[model samples]
Target: MTRAEIFKEMEEMFGLVPSMFKSIPDATLELEWSLFKQVQLAPGEIPAKYRELMGVAISAITKCRYCAFFHTEMAKLNGATPAEIEEAVHYAKSSAGWSAYVNGMQIDFEQFKREITQVCQHVRLARESMGPGDMSE
Candidate 1:
């Protein structure tokens, strides 16, 4: 769509076009732009590339067309190649298969809960390590 057309849509949706939306205008344009910015700039355990890949993975698994397109675009901007993005999606699918297999093999909700808890703990640790205090003094 034309830039002017996009801005017009953004105005209709957001009441005022956000700066980021100025580049791509659409409905909830401001919210979309803000989310993109947060994903890039937020302090988190995951590196930006990993976050981008994660977004792509979620998009792939959930089949969110808009999110897939937006995240793939962001992934490229963050230095992920198209191939790498594809690889991430492949891995996500593979992981899903692994999860299903494990669930079936054990048939125990407790076991699955423990596994999830461990994974969440790891994520928390990683996020903590990413904080400013963790940086070299």
Candidate 2:
């Protein structure tokens, strides 16, 4: 789509053409906007609320205050609670910390992957053996 066409659609959908779209390079604006709409605004298997929450976590880890705030607001619009946003940020911190430790220590990648596989297999087996709502060993 041409930049003009994209801007028309954006205006129709958002009631105004956002400055962000106008600021992008003209050559790739259509592609970028298409991708953003498909991934961020469209219905998908991941669902928008969860995706927004994930965006918040990723934004937090990547130190993008703009994305963090945008995604947090979108998450709320998509039904995420304050508790969920807090937990997402907390999980992102924990994950980033663990990744930093492992990468810094130069842990074996193959062993880590194998351990993760084993853990998943064990958890699947345990879940299969247990009845619904049964978490006790």
State which candidate has the highest TM-score. Answer: 2
For model 2 the TM-score comes to: 0.89
Tens-place lDDT digits, model 2, residues 1-137: 88889999999988998888899998989898999899889999998999999999999999999899899999999999999999999999999999999999999999999999999899889989999878654
Cα deviation in Å at residue 57, candidate 2? Answer: 0.4
- Pairs with backbone N, CA or C atoms under 3 Å apart (clashes), candidate 1: none
**Where is model 1 more than 4 Å wrong at Cα?**
1-36, 40-45, 104-106, 109-137
Instruction: Provide backbone clash counts, one per model.
Output: 0, 0
Best by lDDT: 2
Q: Give the TM-score of candidate 1.
A: 0.50
lDDT of 1 by residue, 87-106 (tens): 99999899888988977887
Task: For candidate 1, give the lDDT of residue 4.
Answer: 66
C-alpha lDDT score of every prediction, in listed order: 0.77, 0.94
lDDT of 1: 0.77
Per-candidate TM-score against the hidden true structure:
0.50, 0.89
